[model samples]
Target chain A: MSFFDRFFGKEKKKSAGVAKDRLMIAIAADRENSRIPNLDQMRAEIISVLEKYISIDEIEISKERKGDMDMLEIEVVVKSTG
Target chain B: MGIVFAVISGKGGVGKTTTSANLAIGTAMEGKKTVVVDFDIGQRNLDMILGLENRVVYDITHIMDGEANLSQALIKDKKNENLYFLAASQTKDKSVLERDKVKHLIDDLKENFDYIFLDSPAGIEGGFEHTIHYADNVIVVVNPEVSSIRDADRVIGLVDAKSHKAKAGETVGKFLLINRIDPELIEKNEMIATDDILDILSVTLLGKVPEDKRVIDASNTGKPVILHKESEAGKAYRRISKRLCGEDVPFEDVENAPSKGIMGKIKGLFK
Candidate 1:
């Protein structure tokens, strides 16, 4: 944080580091939706149906290709009601 | 088949045209028959960058429309016998390029040249897909900024999903070329590091060019920076061109890359 440290190039954190972290999160999110059209709409529909019976914590939709087949995998984490 | 390398970036002004010109010239200097095609259309700058603007008799559209033959449209570089150029039509927009026509042009060029460099325009729309459609390899140029990196990732994804190779259940070669790397900015925590970009993109590191002022000067003179032996960016481009030819050229540690010429040595003494 001091001028001495900056001059010696011993700063613990850099904006570039922060940028890398931010891009990782942003690009991953973008890639997830890029594969499927109307991904958010699809998620909303699924949530509306699921909310009728159960509480959902988080929903993750990922797509992967194996050979000539496309596999769309969904992971739904349920909210615990202890 | 000849290798088609597309110098593409979804964001504009990240040095795609500069890289295309330099790499094409560099490979030609290495004695490989090279042709650089301007696919920018309506905003063509490759001819100006190569200093061959006055000599363009016909362009890519002329060849495709049967108005001119390939030899008539193709302009051989006056300085380099192995290098040639194809100008993009200034009057036509990106929509003028169709898939089949682009394929025919590429196929014809493949029969003559060892390397074909496509200087792609900015944005992911219109003729952008055609540029990467038949690309054997793509050099994704990024400027170490958030918007540039984000747009480049989008283009990378498109290359995977849209390219002819990708459509045929094959993968097109993807390489990362991080441009305008300012070490002083990195030291001041202002710019992204080369390794950080490589880690984020998860692509092979083709080369990293240090930010240089001479690049603009080279552009102004219609000479690619690669021809300047004293320029750091030029040296980096030459190294990248060699790597494209399957040569094992080691990358320079751009953060600590030594400055060339006398003034650089004096500046180093202070550091």
Candidate 2:
């Protein structure tokens, strides 16, 4: 709700959920049958956005497909500044 | 044998029993008399997952060993009148289950239930085969990651070769359910993208579940995700259930569950 709330990490749970939800749908929608061009688009967009802000550390992409549906888990922890 | 459907995974922790338990509940909720038999003998977590641990006395092993009858061993959900459960023996070795005995047991169950859901063990060998051998369809549970996907791919092959349908010169109708997706990580290229999994597994995707902590809470509380209104996993599972019943339904976007908000949280919180 406020700067204090952000600094204290109270809103972290809620906001993290919101942000994760938005990011997942965008990636899923972009994926063609969850195949290739979509993943390439997702990777490019993520890399560009991260380069704009936090210093990139490492990026690993993994995926799982069920029948005709797809699910992805993305773990991103930024590199610390000195 | 009864129309068996095994909810399997190559690796553990991708929600195999979770899916099987809920699908049992969901199938019963739809008025189909269903029984979810926990075949993960010795592990015995299915009862906890279904919230029926305390009531299980006459387990499947008791019936298989001729110590108890099928009806005597089956535990009714009590909450859903149409649902029943047969727990695995907590003390017996998994070797207690023989292929012929299992076939006979499942055959008796098939005569009684419209759907027989088997919560299979993690591997393809031993009890997993005996459990999977009677299935009409197989739902492969996989998380969107390297280890999980690779294992699921292997398990899919195993199911194809090991299923009863395979013996009849037909492959089991395999469907994939990808679980524990995180949208934020995908946006950062930190996690696997949906596309990569499909490229490797090469199976038809049934549905995708978002990484929702509500699932853990629900599982802990002994309720399935489908029971929660606000759960992305719950809602996704409901959609998957409908698809299994041949109903037309759209899949949930794995990334859009959080903003949809409060309702999912409240639903889980109340449960």
Candidate 3:
């Protein structure tokens, strides 16, 4: 383990002999709205927000409907340098 | 191996199921062995649209669960000799579609048929992902409306991000099928034009289906609209099928089409 990894307690664990860094964010639209927002614009906005924290390698957005509200679930895979 | 196409739309009621049924029947009419699998789960409607509801004994779940073999679950179309259908389970929940099971079933089907059409459920739920995961091609259906176009853009993104072809660093061919277009509405500037939709979705235009009442009538009567030779929608689907088969069929001039009147009716009868 590296000095930074041990001090910060950010331990990288391997599952099935492979390592991965995955981030997921769920954004729900306002229930009062009659329709969902434009997904393309939302995706761009979300990526801008995520860029401040991590270097994203790829992003995937999937739509979902729960009861009357619509949701956009975003998944981001961060770049690994090690 | 066969080409697997997923007829998907992010929004519901935009003619995804209707397009799937007609395309399956159209390709079968071209003498290719085709099978369309419904992935809608509990809200199964593809069989109803194909007029094969009464013929469905075993469904996709039964085959995936090993309770029935492929031959036992496959329902040959009553009208088209080369066409077959595998209905979605009405009793099982959408979660029953595990990734491995879906991949196995689709792989097996690809070995036996020339084309496999997966009728994806509306929205980007589990049912939709399961259908698109194994697709080699994708047909995104949309009506000429703002909401429908936006949702279709979302689906186009998913096809790139979620499909096995996409994950393998291979491109899954994507096409846009615009359905229920009304010429009068277009002239009145009430509906979005085909060019605008194509630009927004940024996919090749496969075909457009006109708003023909015969579509609904065919659905109600348990017949695919493609069987109605005189209907404009039927002709459009036939053109789409030929286009899918690598033919260069030209798009119909929707704006120049004869108005629906006695003269048009007479012309249609002759056609």
* TM-score of each candidate structure, all chains considered together: 0.80, 0.71, 0.74
lDDT winner, 1 or 2: 1
Which model is ahead, 2 or 3, in terms of TM-score?
3
Chain B TM-score for each model?
0.93, 0.90, 0.93
Q: Which docking category, incorrect, acceptable, medium or high, applies to candidate 1?
A: acceptable
**For residues A20-78, what per-residue lDDT tens digits would candidate 3 score against the true structure?**
11100111131122234576678788889999988989898766678877676778999
The DockQ figures for the candidates are: 0.29, 0.02, 0.02
Model 2 stretches with alpha carbons more than 4 Å out: A1-82, B257-271
Candidate 3 chain B: worst-modelled 10 consecutive residues by lDDT: B262-271
lDDT for every model? Answer: 0.88, 0.78, 0.82
Model 2 lDDT per residue over B127-202, tens place: 7888778888888998866667666766776675577778799768788888888987765345666666665567
Q: lDDT for model 3, please.
A: 0.82
| Residue pairs with backbone atoms closer than 3 Å in model 3 (clashes) | none
Candidate number with greatest TM-score:
1
Query: Best candidate per DockQ, number?
Result: 1
